[model samples]
Target: MDFDLPESAAAVREGVQAIAREYDQAYWDRCDAEKRWPEEVWRDLVAGGWHSLAIPEEYGGAGQGLLELAVALESLAEGGAGGAASFMYLLTPAFGGLTIARHGTGAQRREFLPRIASGELETCFAITEPDAGSNAIEIATRARLDGDHYVVSGQKIWISGVERADFLVLVARTIPAAEAKPRTNGFTVLLVDVKEAVADGTLSYRPIPKLGTNTVASSMVFLDEVRVPAERVLGAPDEGFAVLWDILNPERILAAASGVGFGELVLRHACDYARDRAPFGRPIGTNQAVAFPLARIKAQLELARLMTHKAAWLWDAGRPCGSEANIAKLTAADAAWQAADRAFQTYGGMAYSLEYPIARMFRDARIAKNIPVAEELVLAHIAQHELGLPRSY
Candidate 1:
């Protein structure tokens, strides 16, 4: 594989960086400190036409590859738009547009995809439940067909951007485990209208206060007998898992890109500080101790970036990339975590201060190890699917 980015990828990165340069560390710090959403960043991304680069061309998108998506995200981070993986930039395409573009019917795609591509619509994804975080098939959220509509009711924890979303790509169990051909069968995906559901009093959400990445609200949402039109169903009935499955690898690949980019940001900050800050008449970077961890972070981050690109390349080529995606996420998260820790150590007391953005990225990096799929679960997948080991979970 070629090491350099293609012309399209370069254009994507350049466009994204132009927008990201508008917001510096201080803006994100105030947003995180107040637990406020970054509306300014969101607006800039929307205006830049950077939000919908990956949806189908017919749907008002640029028809760019997912590698472009990763590049755009990384560009944002590298330009100092750090916390929340530049969620204001990438979340819509990541969770909302990609799934519908792949699996939605003509009408479903017609209604949502263009709006998403135009940055005129935004949505959240709901899958993880309070009771079933990792074991998705065992989820209690259910949708029952009732004449022309389906009644959906369930509790979803850590559902992001509920208040700001126009809709939710909701996963509900349509067939009970006992009645399914396989235990994983019978779940259905629905595109539920968030405003209508809430106005009718069928949905309510409480924002989750988080340690970092506070630009978007991580929410606990409760759905009580929400009515969704039958036409809102994504893919075939009881085939929701397959629709979700199409997006998981991309999600992992995107998460890997975010983590790897954040690692690069941290390393840059530390290296710059070490190069300039001198004590005892010599730059601190002259000391092996100060320089070594940054070097290690640089090496590991490049390794993660390569893995991520391989996975994204395979995915964009429409090849089976499950194992590669999982491995990329695992390695990138590890690299980001170590990078953040080293950044903290390298910055010393300043790391603890809110004045420095490194602390924010470091805190946010802590969440990467566990999200978009945990490292432990990625290892489980590598073992079971890649190494021919028995399924442990």
Candidate 2:
């Protein structure tokens, strides 16, 4: 029941916060307005060594655990420099590079890990398709083995940071869902070289215009006749479904941490406004309406933060954390959105102004409800796994 972060994590938080504080709200606002990647902010974070905190030491990473990385990400988000886009960019390594470290071959690790650890290479992951949003088993992407290469073809939507990435951790099926011995056993992950695929005209991408989190653009990707060497296969052929856990579990935990930090930032803004804005001879915070919602949101965020840490702890301990991970994201997502809503209400007209960060926080908070795993899907997992109910889908 230790509520505090360990000294190591506290040090990470301190370093991350120091870098984050250097970038002001206006800098983030400019990035959003221009739809530009926060390269300066990314460089600052990498310079702080937070980028390689979770990578194994042999691969030139610091060999830290999920707990340490989550603390760094949370601190970054709360610092007002990294909104949803920066948070999402930082998460790419957790989902992409960490998987390579865990399940990739010795050669595969040697080829990619060092570049990834140095932040010289950016990674993006693709899982969703035009047809299958959450159902990985139903995806239509297929890879055919041909001599030393696998020829791949499919369309992927809502892929984040594809343009910024040197490569993509791609998911495709070697065996069709209908033809496989087990539906889940038909998929495979490949480390696809983006520049090579594009150079050869096998891959094409177009940025998908989004509402918020514009710092990192999400895009639609097309792959046709893309050929990747067999050596690039991440794990055993048709066993990628199991390997995906290496990405998904950490993704949920980090996403939870991002939302938790966002909620706290929103509450801080709301509280500041409530304490200073006076309308009826006293600060608006004197009104129960303003004070109560902020109070309640603070309480909920505390619980959500605890669940986030617990999920990270279980994951770092090499224990099964499927239930905890799902609940952590679900809890944090709801709290983040509610806190944003309260802040927007507290600021009223000023919230619409770009000068304040509330509008951006509100827009970014909306994404947490549907990212990595949707709220409905998490509830379904809890219903089936935790409540002893039969699977619905």
Candidate 3:
């Protein structure tokens, strides 16, 4: 419940921002225009150790909590875009390595965590299917047992970083739906080597064109009877849902934090434009029409920031944070959207022009409401968990 970050956390933010400042908006703008990934920035982050800040010290990481991780990611988004945050977190062990750390055995950790912490390897988590979407349990991907390996067959859409990742954390059904003890049962998690699968023609991928965050490539991946070593199975054979909890909370919180940063960046731009633009012999900001709404968005962003920090703190402390994480993501996404819209409106016709960064930030902010988890889904979780309403889905 601490309102202020500890000195160590503050130092992490300062260090990350210092490196991020080297890449200005113009550089990011060019990257976005070309649909190019930020390889230079990614390498710089890795060199500075900001990429491995969250991994445990024993595993060659700094062992920082999620709050510090959230702050660092938020600053990156504020400094650049969600692409930068994605590069930092997606490239790190947080996505798959953390899942393995929580549910992995000593052998698994020894096999993967250190290499992941050092950025020697990367993993992409494949869970979303075309038919399943948010209904993860409805996915039809199957992993059947073999002599010393499991044969996996499935299709996943919107799987990010697959082209560059060395391994994949895959979710597949180990038990048939008819025999599943619960609707969520029968799902299994496995880590598969991407190179071997592709070489064997068991895995294939095609890049998916997206509107934003183009720096991180997402793809439609197919796994046709891919063989994964038995040791690659994470947690139990049919307990993927439990294993996902360790990853999703951090994902939601990190997304919320990124939203807050984007909002702040928009607010700064809007305020600057409002102060300089003159209409009717007075600054446009003089009219309460523009100024009041902008002020409100500023307030909303601050409020979302508080909630995001709280959610990250609770999650890092090993407390149950499903409710808080949902609210944090919902509030921050809404606030960012509001701020981006106001920024667009404040910029008038110029807002629609690509020359101004607000237009891109607006598009990026809108995407925040949809991905990582949609706002509608967040509301559903809140209604059920926070208000004690019956589950809608």
**Top candidate, metric lDDT:** 2
Q: Give me the displacement of residue 273 in model 2, in angstroms.
A: 0.9
Q: lDDT per residue, candidate 3, 1-393, as tens digits? A: 457888868998898788778988888888878877787887776777777777678888787778887888888887766434655564454676567666888898888888877768888888899998877778899999999899999899999889988988888999877789887898888999999999999999999987777777889999999999988889888887888777778888888888888888788889999999997788899989999999998889889989898998888788999888888889998898998899999999999889988877877788878878988999999888888999998
The residue pairs found clashing in candidate 2 are: none
- Candidate 3 regions exceeding 4 Å error are 82-84
Which 10 consecutive residues of model 3 have the lowest summed lDDT? 82-91
Q: State the C-alpha lDDT per candidate.
A: 0.84, 0.86, 0.83
Candidate 1 C-alpha lDDT tens digits along 183-299:
878989999999999999999999887788887888999999999999999889998877877767888888888888788887888888888878678888998998987898888
What TM-score does model 2 achieve against the real structure?
0.97
The local lDDT score (0 to 100) that residue 16 gets in candidate 1 is 84
RMSD of each: 1.4, 1.3, 1.6
Ranking by lDDT: 2, 1, 3
Model 2, residue 252: distance off in Å is 1.0
After TM-score superposition, the amount by which residue 5's alpha carbon in candidate 2 deviates from its true location, in angstroms, is 1.7
Native-structure RMSD, model 1: 1.4
TM-score for each predicted model, relative to the true structure: 0.97, 0.97, 0.96
State model 2's lDDT.
0.86
